[model samples]
Target: MEENKREVQVTLVESILIMIGMFAILGALIIGAEMPPQIPILLVFTLLMFYGRLRHVTWDQIFAGIIEGIKPGIIPIMIFLMIGLLVSSWLRSGTIATIMVIGFKILSAQFFLLTVFLICCLIGITVGSSFTTISTMGIAFMGIGHILGFSAAITAGAIVSGAFFGNNMSPLSDTSNLTTGLTKVNLYDHLKNMAITAIPSALITLGLFFILGRTSSTADLTQTQQISQQLQRSFNVSIWALLPILVLLLLAWRQVPAIPTLLVGSLTALVVILVSSPGYSVSQIGTLLMNGNAAKTGSHTVDRLMSGGGINNMLGSVSLIIVALALGGLLIQYGVVHTLITSIKQYVNTPGKLILLNMLSGIGVNFLVGEQYLSIILPGTTFMSSYDRLGLPRKYLTRTLASGGADVNALVPWGVSGVFIAGTLGVNPLAYVPLAFYAYIDPIITILFGFTLVTWRYRRSGKRPATSTATTSVGLKDRDQPVN
Candidate 1:
């Protein structure tokens, strides 16, 4: 809200044209041309900088925006590194191997995909981190997918769906908390409001995954058995190997910060490895920590499946995120995003239309800005005045913000969530987008229910008395219930 030291006066259309051009070029290069996304995105950043300079904005102001925008992503970048460490350490300690060994035995081949989805959901909710869940158990599921002869794309989809579902719904999740905090909605109320759409979407997604699992599973037990035997031969695949997962869960439940918790998990696994395998020396452990796990188990299948992790493995994703954040910062500094959304606000006169516009705004900003947090902050701030005028509970804003914006981030091929997920899981985000049922479904149902029913009403006499600033909350209830 601070007045800019320098401004680049850009028209709405100019901004739109630039964004469309960027997306089109990015799409062509990444998909049609089969190129990595880094170059195309970096190109867009250069174009934005050029646009800023054309408007006579100073280099300092422009870079300031970039710095502030990228500030939020530092933690995520650090966590990505920790994930590299965790996955590599877990693999070395046989944690990943044990999960696969037990998973193949207890889980029916027909239910494989559903289990991946559900387990990821549980871990995501518990851990409150999609990236961590994906890097850890999600990686294991990839190996299982290969063993079961399931399509990699669909398998990645199931994992992404589960991870995002947990991320959206859990109180521990940063995005979930960010959504509530930004809208000034009570966290509990925000979650309760999300249930109407979230639950149905989850059920539908679950059903679909179940069907996909049934049809796609070839149940190649020979591969599974071979993998299991190789894992057993290579490392100590036992209940002790699972202690590291328990350590992570406990840390999450106790509300420890993610970095420290992951550090502990990684260190714990290292200790476990030392204890389990007397032969693995400090040099070997150091090598794994720096370079990631390398499996030379003589079985190419096991080697390929288990060979992912380490700080080195995560740097590419970390770089992509930092770049995206820098771009977001630049856009915010120029006010390009704000102007574009404001231009659209005039057409949203009716309540239904307002609801739809709100959803679209989230999605729009998600694409424009390439970061999930901004998707919530931008649209939520933009529409608060409108919501206040309508006397709507703030929870509606928060719910729609999360489902419409935050959830959609992972589905955008060039966005932060998409880039991170794809890079971490070794699956192209575009390939997984179709199957990432939860990510896309959240927005559809959030907007659908918004038009058809009352998302949330103040608990009192249902009158907050319209104001342009703050609104009163008597409490909140679902659509069917009268605003008691």
Candidate 2:
């Protein structure tokens, strides 16, 4: 007869072993072999499953754990897919093209780096996507910088800095939403809390870019004009294109749910597309929604910028989230997370220490795993109890996750964001690290605030209990005893 076994609490040693194995496998494959994160993450998942099986965990129980882990991510996955649709629809309706045209018209060579930074920031915020901004406006800015005799490294740095800055703050940002969702913090509240550090970092970045961008050469605007002309030729570059974005902003301002807000925005864009381009068939519109925009503007740069989005594009992120969450769930189910947290609980005595630890863990995960999502997921899940036990709100955790995880990814040489930026901008990833000022600066400011207790919000009682017990599906049962 087969034997039935109850779930076992993973010991501290076992937890450490699991972590070490995870780090080794992820680092070896993702960094050493330079494979995409999905494969490495899958390997880690398999490793955890083997460990679980040795501990007598049943396949049924394992499946349950996976489901539990994925539950928290379902909403985020939906939002990611919606964002894809929104991007594709907006592109088809000329919304993105119009914005790009406006951004190009305002460019001046005198404040080239500053203008590049500001334009990227604008586009990033408007689109609420760093990669999109980087691939499009960032590519154009790099071409302009090369012609104007600016160092490619400094220009790439400016692009990354501005793009991530807008990404960190924009309500429509997937990372921003993912942070808030995982931490259960209100989206607007999270954005507001982040501004405490984001604004200052942006200002410092602006000043640095301005100082570095001082160039005496009067460069021709031929490249810029060509790209702008191509965009204008391909799409309707007019004020009407702004309507969908305005509607999205209005819905977000009213605090509507992210999924619906994105859907409404996409639908609005579709309406605009149908009205303006009556020649578009229903099947063509469907293709755009499913496969993204395919029309070429005859300019390679313009074509690159215009071609992206669609539900299919988000499947990779969706799959990663599912697998990563399943890993997290198994870790929690087997008590690896609890054991590790308990071991570290004594050292994270204060909010400052907790914040610092979370930041460090995030950066470490980014370096080790080379994936931004895992960096946010692992640290955010690990430190959640620490945040609650100290009477601190979870928004602080959300902000720090953004500071240490999402923003920092673009600086890691092997990181997904870093690799993409390097390839798109034609500069070595490491070369631009020094100039990607906002990425590191935000984390520094967040850590400083933690130590100084600046802008820190506490519970209404302003006093936390010595210990609190909580139990959930992921099994955070161990009570945290904060050090006095």
Candidate 3:
């Protein structure tokens, strides 16, 4: 069976056809028909299964591939559930309300978007998780944006751009650490190299957002004051409400795993609700956790802002992730992705071509697989030897991975990050793509660097680039296996 499997290689034509078919089906169903992404993804998965059968792959092989694909998303799925709980807990504990109230008092309409971008950047860097930032700070900003009369699409765009920028740069981010670990580059060196592109992209993004803020509709001070007063009355808005956010950030800084950090944050929120409010019983808290905050704060704006969160709200995202990952698994199991990568490798003779191809491959994987980790892992692994052969330092490859793989995932409509963000922010996933300047800008800058050799570093003649010993500190056991 192993020998037979080795002999079964998907041709370039077959791979290309499958990819085109996938895009067509997804486009027709998602864009043309305006159906939800899960249905289209499931249809694509079924078609791929049939295609796999035609390629002589066994049913067992296909099922195994799906299971393998889902393995990568298990932690993310767990995080999703915990995030649902955390959001609701924070809502009940007045954390989000306090942030919104405080934001209205200090944040101006002129720099609202700019301030939102910077604040989210700080929170994202501190937490090292885009999802967490999006759920907590992102939610608060959305409420403020609504109260301030900004469009949700534009607000979500700025939030996503800043959150992902920090995610790419944070030392504790899984994708950043994964990119450096897989490519055998020093973490800090990769970060510094990433700045070559990241800085320009971020500055450009900030400028664009500043202009948007300037042109935004004037803030309604009366409405803002009314909402602030209502929020204070409905929830116990105090400094004590911020303990949950502080706890989450401190755990992230300490390098604790994401799951435990979220769990602890949720637990802390429950404690805050009990000690600070003292009106709700333990049973009521459990009910709130399961069914979300049911408090009718009397103000329509406050009610709209605080009504969501709970495991029920997250089930849609979780379902979408499962189907998408299963589809990605079949793509990998059927050799479509491998064929595409191998066919593209022949033309990567120069450093410029290699960098461009690497970036494109990472973006392509995000579109095809809808999983971010594979976007980094596949291209980084495929081109690792090529970079070494070209005498280019591994930092270039890792930086490119962050630019193309990690950052771009949020723009992919069916991607895990995209789905989660859309569900959390209550915006269409595609609506914010055009405004996510940093996500797309970094790749363009990195590609330009590749062609210009502006920031490229070369290994000494007759010597290969040395692997960084610092990789062990990131807890990477071996190059073959990245930490989850």
lDDT per residue for candidate 1 within 1-484, as digits (tens), equals: 2466445556888778877887898888888998887787788889888888988888888878888888888877888888889989998899999999988888887898899999999999899988778888898898888789898899999999999888888899888888877766678777787887888999999999999988987876877787788899987899999999999999999989899999999999998998998888888888899899998999888888888788888788877887777887887778778888888887764456677899898888788777888888888889876666666666778888888777899988767788878877898777889999999898898777776675333323455435433334322332223334
- 1-484: candidate 3 lDDT, tens digit per residue: 4444455467889899989999999999998999999999999999888878887888778887898788899999999999989999999899999999999999999899999999888888888889989999999999999999998999999999899989987898899889977876778877787877888888999999999999975678899999999999889799999999899989999999989998899999999988987777878877787777776977777899987888888999999999999999888877788889868887976668889999999999999999999999999889887665555667778988888888889999899999999999999987889988888988999999888753233311233322444332323223322111
RMSD of each: 3.0, 6.6, 4.6
TM-scores of the models, in the order given = 0.93, 0.72, 0.93
Model 2, range 252-322, lDDT digits (tens) per residue?
Answer: 55657667878998999999998999998999988999988775877776777677778887676666656
lDDT of 1 at 382: 92
The lDDT-based order of candidates, best leading, equals: 3, 1, 2
**Candidate 2, which segments miss by more than 4 Å at Cα?**
1-6, 109-196, 211-220, 349-351, 361-436, 452-484
Could you tell me how far off, in angstroms, the CA of residue 168 lies in candidate 1 after the best superposition?
1.6
> Which TM-score value belongs to model 3?
0.93
How far out, in Å, is residue 394 in model 3? 0.6
